[model samples]
Target: MSDRALIPLLSAIALTAIIAACLVGSTTMSPGRLLAAMVGAGGAGDAIVLWEIRLPRAIAAFVVGAALGLCGAALQGLLRNPLAEPGVLGVSACASLGATLALFYGAAALSPIAVPVAAISGALAATALLAFAAIHTSSVITLILIGFGLSSFAGALMALLLNLAPNPFTLSDLISWTLGSVANRSFDDILLAAPFMIVGLVFIVLSRRALSALSLGEEAAHGLGVDLPRARGFVILGTGLVTGAAVSIAGAIGFIGIMAPHLVRPLVGYDPARTLAPSAILGGVILVLADIGVRLIPSPAELRLGVVAALIGAPAFVWIAIGRGRTHG
Candidate 1:
């Protein structure tokens, strides 16, 4: 098969292996027993560990990773910014701050839906404000400046909430969650995030054709019959919602949005339509593997997935920056 075709197949196999490894590594069970538990043949202890614990984290990693990937692609395509990312642009921070507030004020503690709902609202609000700032600015640099401003504001608010939390445990939990982890995610968390992700996915998928048009530049896209304003709105809405759900569950896992899409874009021969799906798959694979790697590398104490990704991505970013400098120079 060609390189384009090989990627999806490889990604699928890699994801399966990582998932299997996670299941096996989470406890002392052999692969055979893990498979048995997965297939409902094992006993209650197997069921509890495999299903109740490992399964949820695995699924969360996949779903949240997919959302992050899709959002990254959409935001990059919409803004035509290689560095545009939900977390980096600060939308995820806004969502986290909103969720933190809800939890701190006992709104989410009192109602099951409050955290995600509040988070989605906050994400949408931030996007809207950013959009408004972008509209008046007349330049991409201005847009980036506005995005940075919004992100900074949201981050500051999150810090304030951390200071005001009622107890040290609450503060620690919120802080750690903001640092991002898929450990001990529940069915409720899945349900809460699913709708936003699904809806966002639909909009993102719909924008594939528009994204292709967009790659040629907005004026050219409009000249070619793409509805620029409508497409922009759709992309913004999709990114915001997907980002919100991801933050609500996984906290602010940065760079996956920018890193995943950019890495995969060249593999698809720069076809934006093909880029989105493959990026999503690779994104899921990346996060799952990162989570599993963190678990395996340190053994008992469990390293954070975000830290692992950052370590890898930080070097990758440096390499990319150096390459770009050489190319331009």
Candidate 2:
């Protein structure tokens, strides 16, 4: 389908996903009951489930997916590499590390907010560092390498923290946060992350035209009046904020950001700017569906959302990589 047509379709699908998410869970509620609850005529229990639990979780899933997808689309466009994701910048790793620290130090035991706050702080710190580096060099390859190195370092640190974990409980908490999930995510989680996500999205959107120019090559983009360094700063900071806030609550969800854009790119003819919104919509839908899948699974213990994403995404990544190799060859 044409992008103009596909965009609306994606939006509608996203809406459907949100609706489905609200309705599908371990405990079933018929559509009639849900609708009655929505109109305030159902039992109080239905209202609590619909309004307090399902709706907030669905909305949170939608927004988190969209933000991460936006970052992935922007990054791929800027890097001119189809495989790039927010993780490429090490923001997710840093956020994970931050949460690990909170778990390690027992800060999370004191309050529910500690882990998310630390994760956001870690992500923003990485963004600032990357932004400063961007000022020194305008080479995209250098930036990617730097991000890779940072990610590796953060991963190592996280491993060290895990090794030194004081007890099994701390170890479990660390593992859980690193694995990622959207279950039990309340409205407060959405509210806490929304501001940062919005600002991050605005930054990416601001860089959209530059991203399009960049597809023509850096020199061409520069000649076309794109301030390459500032644009890089915008993407790094924007992606960092979005990814960081997401990791705070969801705990390092993966693949949705990458898969979302790739799924929508063809419909938009691979134009980076044109791909963003639809990609975001698809990302949200994909995550909500994934969350719903975890809920409906008959396993004694539910799978983490990130685990499901990796199972689905890693092979797809390789497939895309191999396909791109053949296409270029």
Candidate 3:
């Protein structure tokens, strides 16, 4: 389908997913009641449930998912690698490491803002390292290897922190946070992350044309007057902001960044620039649906959103790897 046609369809699907998410919690709510509650016309109890709990949680899912999707598309286009993702690139891992440090040292307890700020700092640091590595080498394989090293290092750091936890409670909290979820998130979390997400998204959007030029090859992109360094800066900064902010609140949700772009690429005719919006929308849809499924599944305790995402994402990652291997072979 054309981009024009697909936008409406994707928007409709995203809206439907959001509405479904709002209605599928433990206390099932009808659409009319949900709407009335949102508009402040429902019963006090329903109003609280709808406005205070479900609404914020659902919005968080959408926003985080959108950030992941956009970052994934931007990275894929920037690196020209199908396997590039925040988690795979160690960006999310680094962010997790930063948050883990905050939690371990009790900085997070001191202030709600500390964790997110630390996470964003880690993400930006990782992105800067990646960009620096890219500057010295044009090889995709080298960049991927660097990302692998970064991810491994971050993972090791987190594991060390877990081993040194002062108590089992701290260990459990760290583990749960790394497992990722938007459950019980408030508008406060959303408000905290929104500015970073928005700024990062704008940076990515501004580089669309540059991404399109780079898709043709560096020499050609240069010939077409694309400032390669500036483009890289935008992508790196944007990815850091979006991925870091997302990890701060959501705690390392994976694969949406990788999977969302791939899912919508064909729909957008495989144009890198065109893939951004659809990927973001589809990412939001996927997360909202996943969050709803986590709630609906029969369990004494709700499933973590990150676990659900990894369950789905891991298989997809394997499939993509296999497909790429076959194509290359």
Candidate 4:
């Protein structure tokens, strides 16, 4: 790798290692026992804590983060807008509302698949709306405006549902999920999301060449034999799948979709293909660190991971807007 790429690659690995250490340290298992448990040589409780609890949560974090990263990258590529993200598309909001509605109607408790299925359906619905809007107006600003309107509608619907729900606990649970916390996510959550994540990643990984080709401009990409419709379709489907699955588990953890790709794009010399893996790794690390920070600073109450991300993301967003203003001026 070039020096530029080497640094991010090393940084990604280091962040991963630090996150692994933090996870082990934070849990009941000691460093030595956690190491032993990894090799299947620990006591039953240590093994259970390491394997059953921490391992799944860590894996879930990675998968969820990776999904967000890849989905964001794909959306940006498809939209030809650096600011495009799963969140901006209103897919995350739609999924959040879907999960909330499920909880409100007691469907989530009725079946294990209800939440994921509903969330995915909601994301697809948002994607469909975007597509319909795109047909009418191809402008990026218009697309974003429509997405914002959809998100607002979804958020309002969610609040209404929560208010009308008979059970207060259900409303609270739904609200907490909307705030986005990874605490107590089980192996079942991992299982439910894994297939979607994998399939989504595979599609996105294959689309890297298409993304890079499109960077030359859609007309040029078409002239060079790139199939525009197929490429855009893949991006939309892959992003929807990954983001939907992530929302199903983590409940609309926003900003990582925007942050991860932006953070790594410079290191890759703006190459979307190279940025992909680094973004995924960094996304996982950032969220894990954010989660760790949430636990440490907030103490026993535990901070919401989405809140932490937004705290970081909102400032970065302001900086971006200011930078754009300076450039335009």
Which tens-of-lDDT digit does each residue in 124-238 have in candidate 3?
A: 9998998898778888778878988998998888889888988999998789768899998999998988888889999999999898888898789999999999999999999
lDDT tens readout by residue for model 2, 266-325: 888889999888988888888888888878887878898888877887787778778888
Tell me the tens digit of each residue's lDDT in model 1 across 1-329. 35567576857765685567456564567777788888999898988888888778877887777788878788777776666677767787888888888888889778888888878877888777766665465466677667677778887888888888889988987886577888888878988889988897888888889988878887788999998778877777887788888888877777777678888887777767767887777777778877778777855667777777777766765576567568756
Q: Report, for all candidates in order, the number of backbone clashes.
A: 0, 0, 0, 0
lDDT leaderboard ranking: 3, 2, 1, 4
**Which parts of model 3 have CA positions greater than 4 angstroms off?**
none
Top candidate by lDDT: 3
lDDT of 4 by residue, 34-145 (tens): 7787788978877777666766666666667767877777777766667777777788999888878887787988998898888877887887678666656768789888
What local distance difference test score does each model get?
0.77, 0.82, 0.89, 0.76
TM-score of each: 0.91, 0.90, 0.95, 0.90
Q: What is the lDDT of candidate 3?
A: 0.89
Which regions of candidate 2 are displaced past 4 Å?
A: 106-117, 125-149
Instruction: Specify the poorest-scoring 10-residue window by lDDT in model 3.
Output: 134-143
